[model samples]
Target: MENQVAAASGKLGVLVPGMGAVATTFIAGVEATKKGLAKPIGALTQMSNIRLGKRTENRYPKIKDFVPLASLEQIVFGGWDVYNENVYQAATNAKVLQQTQLDAIKAELEAITPMPAVFDREYVKNLDGQHIKAKDTKWNWALALMEDIKNFKEKNNCERLVMVWCASTEKYIETTDIHETIEAFEAAMQADDDRIAPSMIYAYAAIKMGVPFANGAPNLSCDIPALVDLAKELGVAIAGKDFKTGQTLMKTIVAPGLAARALGVNGWFSSNILGNRDGLVLDDPDNFKTKEVSKLSVLEEIFQPEDNPDLYGELYHKVRINYYPPHGDNKESWDNIDIFGWMGYPMQIKINFLCRDSILAAPIVLDLALFMDLAQRANMSGIQEWLSFYFKSPQTAEGLKPEHDIFKQLIKLQNTLRHMMGEDLITHLGLDYYQDLVESL
Candidate 1:
């Protein structure tokens, strides 16, 4: 069934929470793409292709062409940051992109500056920035953020806006009674209960303002019951928990292959070292626990030890992160996998990956913004499990399992797009064509 989707018109305001390495890199990359200085390499909205109809039809189209997504030229960038630097300055400090490329779009980046951010050091102990909103009750903080969103939309002449959390990871916190319902959550916010987090305030502000919210960190932003109910009630689309990049990205890609081959994984040890702000925040044990949980859960879901006990029942998983200032935004990871094959034959796979953190994450931020915007325009509300392809720990409905296999996630995403556009969903049943040919005889 084809659903009517609004045409992509006017400027889409892409508002990010933290204008740090990932956010700045994304903004700069978009500016560079507009100027023909660089390409949007990893963003599926810009670069990936979708297949429609039968294989014999040979119909393939770029995702941007198939779906009604905001064009790169039609996007406006603005966000909040604890640091008062403009996008250009923030990009330079990040060192993710070279100086020469930044020079080309320096003026455009400089034109965009971060507004005061709603920050609290208690949540992210490692970061304390001077450019923060006035210390106030949580309700007031949400209101202030909503005001910022309004002013930004009017000032920039944006037709629509979406918020993506590109900030540091907050310390781990479980859902409590305050997160059970909207009334309780708002009451806690008004009471300034410590249970509410700054990210939740941002989420509440965006959803209340009718702007779609996507979380790029492993924090409990819009994943709780209160916000899920709020999004559905307000008819806003929301997705995420963390952007899948670097080590976790590799894990999702590789683990599925092992499972498909029926390889028994006995143990998997994953370690990463990066000097970026993310690494620093994760250096704190509480914050690292949040990230650890996100990274570790990928395997269990993909392997399904409960279903395949002989193959994965004894699986042991360990994840570690180290903060090494010398590496800056360059993140290096090592994975040691212990697997057994037929007759319990033991084997091992070792992989050492040296990757740029923001470089890998920049496109994810861009894609989530555009896709989330499309979801909103299409009237798809609540948890967007179809956009799970870009997240590490995708937020799902209550008691639903998240699809961790990257290939499966991609199929779900593509099928959703097909379903949205009134096209036949491909099920890879090519034998049907042969059966028809034989029946004609």
Candidate 2:
């Protein structure tokens, strides 16, 4: 028997919590892709293919053709942002896309002005904006957001809605008693508890409305127990923690290979220079701590220090984000690795990756929104870990360590799609090949 999954029909509304550099880029890119003015260079939903059946089946198909995903042309974009500017204005300010590109879709981008956002100066200390909901209570603010969601869906004529948190990295906060239960969390919101964050408010509002939510930042947006339990209760699909772009994206890809080969590492130092809104938010020590934790967890999990203490237990991993205005969204990262091979001979690897931050991240936003919405349609709910391939610190069920190895995450993602489509899950066991060969002969 198969799970009762819904088909992807009708328009999908993609709501973003923070309509800044990354959100604007993604919005414009989607619009451009729809207009046939540009190709979706990095989006997997538009560009990736999936393997099915067996290695010999020759059954690979583009993921979009394999699954029932909403067409890009049918996607309508709306979002909330602290800045009152429309997406066009924000995109122009971002300077990521050129004027010629923005000019092609000017009207559409301008029409999608940002709704006033739920903002708190305390959670994001580095930046402040005038366009914000000033409700005294978090509960009231959440109520207001819920109203916004309802209006957006109706106005957009959307058959479904999904929210992606494209906001700044919130100041680090541990999960406390208030986050243990939805009841407690609602009480904390009603009480205006300082521990509750704006992202959490957005999450509460989205999941409560039965909308699928994907977190694109490193804050504990939907990762808290309150939201997770509520998602399960509400039967909504959710994924989160951070969009794995730039350096961490590279780390997840390369670190797993080293561990696979049983390589020894003494130290791995990573640092980045970026000037996007995200970089500025992360420049704050408190905000950076949250990003630091997310970026630092990958190697430890990939290397499994508990399993190979000698190789990684003393692994001195340090990550830094420097705010440099000149770089803008063009983030340049540097990594220095100290490794030992065969009888403890020391070798060093230095990598300097000059990457466009939002360029890489915008596609991640698209893939997550599409896949999370697909999960909801597939009757999947709560902590979609198979979607972990797109995140830096993936949210897992309680007592579960997130998989950070990029290749493994891809296999899980592909297998989930296969399972959803009633195809056999690939296990890479090929004893059947011999039997099939004899039969064919």
Candidate 3:
């Protein structure tokens, strides 16, 4: 009883909406890996393995071997960016990787130039670029993007394509009346409503074209009911709202361990300093609110404060990000956690993480692009909560809370893969072998 998944053959084009540091870094890394210069370190689809049977059966296989995924050599890269620099120049400007490393694949990077991007200053107020689409109605811009998609697919000869939003966070936007249905959304686009952000326009174009779209920003880009419904109607797959990296990544990993141990958390104060374009975009209070909401939601869902009032109800969590040019793409984060145990005895946990922001996120871009393509081939569409392991605020079905624990997210991810291949699901409740102890006792 295997799921009917389409064959992963032919060239697969990975399209991105923004070709900034993160996007350029991801492109450069993939090119470097193809040339045998470096390994894709953080991507699970490339590096992780899956178990297919019971504990007694040694059937662990690399995920790429188990699942039909595109090979590194079979990938073709194309994207749009407000800054029209080629990937090589963009990667050099990013300063996330060394000049020597980039020079090794200079020709390959330089050959990939970004197409004009759809941007509005209102959504991201901190920066401006000359390489943007001409001012026009939102509906017109989306049509132009659809044309771009068609041209890219034909030029690359891609049998399949997926859109991963490696872009800046637009200002926080709530789902409004316009976002309730595809018809209302199209009307808003035609009317040039201010609420229709550029990211949504890209998403609409991709999903309407039956392409899978994965959002790596905190903006409610493709998470709205309208887009979710559109994805289902078009038989396209979509997943979104922020790549989980740095501080929030650590929080999801640690908070779950705390909850498992029943540790009573009082306060968790987290702060970050980064000098990338992301840090600057987030410096704007409006944009920061979007990122902050995504980061803060992890602890609450992981802790389940409402379910265990005494352990987590009084929790105080604050998150901050400051723009510091000196840090460049190397972001630093500090977390101060206060917990109580043994009749209210206080204990403190402190963590200082000096991490490269793009370095951690580049692999996420890779994994999502590959996984979203897999989802579409497997006939899965709409909100992809199983792919929630890579996001901070993953989109779920309406009225459903997102799962934020990294361990549980990993399990769900693995189980999804097993299910797709018709392998037995692993439940980790292997005490049946000990049944003889009950009779002996």
Candidate 4:
């Protein structure tokens, strides 16, 4: 397909729906990175290298150098929040960074304030935000969000904009008749249907405005058929259901390693305790259900019991998230994985990871925003399956099962980038290189 969108240049505004911990950390990290305060360590597009062609070719280039992505300096950050705090205050409240680190970018951080959020008390029962839209109907609230987007774009002088949902997960909502079609969804919004969550309103506004949208939380933001169809129709890139960070990130990494070794996992019990606003929100079972679905899917897709029944068919995977106020945003996860080896000898691998929730999520937010913008510029619409590497439960095209194996997901992501820039997809088939030598001899 011929590329139709203009080349990505000038400033790209990253409009976040939630400007709490992850959002602030992301913006601060970018500012810190720009001022040489910190390096973008986990960002693949910024730090990782891609191997092109045969191993003998010795062609390894940084991924950014290969693709036409927006520079970190060129990325402008703005977003909505339930709290009216600026990025600096939000960062301080989050307590994810050291005082000295925050002080370094104090001025830049203080200047960015969150626009009033379009939030509802029902979806996230644990959170009560005084800073929210007061509109009566969902459609009116959505139009207000569109106005925010336009004003943000004009004020920031951005050539393009992308919205990433870094808000807390909403209550678990199954796809309903309201979510079945664009027309039904529009009518539902107009009628203020009780089933429709606040996040969907934000998503509707973004997709209608032709802005690329990515969901960082596990909320059903852009995942519904209505939004998916709208995205494709509008030709804007969309990705996610959740950000793949912390425990799930580790799960994708370790589960693949276990599968590669053909180890039999009898049970995997994972639990985490965090005290961030996200944790506070998820403390409610309804909200946690949303996160649970996104968290639990990795093992089923990764192990693929149909193919490796003996190794994975009996696997019992359980995930739990607790709200422990003492820990705050520093999420500590304990995973006890029960496995059996060659002779079916039972063994266990226990991991206790003490990770900062927002710190880990910050870079992911940056990568998604940049990559989603790149995907839009490259004219790749619909569900951005290539960016699946960054998501927890990647939204894919209907009828296609998502590839959950991290290595395969990585290859798909990298290959998509290569394909976009007219480069050959690396398949690890080096027969051609050896064939040349054999013929020459």
Task: Give TM per candidate.
Answer: 0.99, 0.98, 0.98, 0.97
Pairs of residues at least 3 apart in sequence or in different chains that clash in candidate 3:
none
- Summing lDDT over every window of 10 consecutive residues in candidate 1, give the lowest-scoring window: 1-10
lDDT for position 45 in model 3: 89
Query: Deviation in angstroms for 266 in model 1?
Result: 0.5
lDDT of 2: 0.92
The count of backbone overlaps in candidate 1 is 0
Candidate 3 global lDDT: 0.94
Sort all candidates by TM-score, best to worst.
Answer: 1, 3, 2, 4
Residues 1-441, model 1: lDDT tens digits: 355788889999999999999999999999999989899999999999999999888899999999999999999999999999999999999888999999999999999999999988989999989999999999999999999999999999999999999998998999999999999999999999998989999999999999999999989999999999999999999999899999999999999999999999999999999998988899899899999999999999999999999999999999999999999999999999999998999999999999999999999999999999999999999999999999999999999999999999999999999999999888887999999999999
Root-mean-square deviation per candidate: 0.8, 1.4, 1.3, 1.4
- TM-score for candidate 3: 0.98
Error of 4 at 205 (Å): 0.6
Q: Supply candidate 4's per-residue lDDT for 342.
A: 90
Residue by residue across 189-307, what tens digits does model 3's lDDT show?
Answer: 99999999999999999999999999999999888989999999989999987999899999999999889989999999999999999999999999999999999999999999999
lDDT of 2 by residue, 1-441 (tens): 145667888999999999999999999999998889989888878999988887877988999999888889889999999999999999999999999999999999999998999999999999989999885899999999999999999988999999999989999999999999999999999999999999999999999999999998889988898999999999999998799988998898888878877889989999999998988898889999999999999988998888998788888999988999899999999999998878878889899999998899999999988998899988899999999999999999999999998898989998988898899998887889898889999
Off by over 4 Å in 2: 1-3, 435-441
Give lDDT per model, in order: 0.94, 0.92, 0.94, 0.90
Stretches off by above 4 angstroms in model 3 are 1-3, 436-441
| RMSD over all Cα atoms, model 3 | 1.3
Look at candidate 3 and tell me the lDDT of residue 82.
90
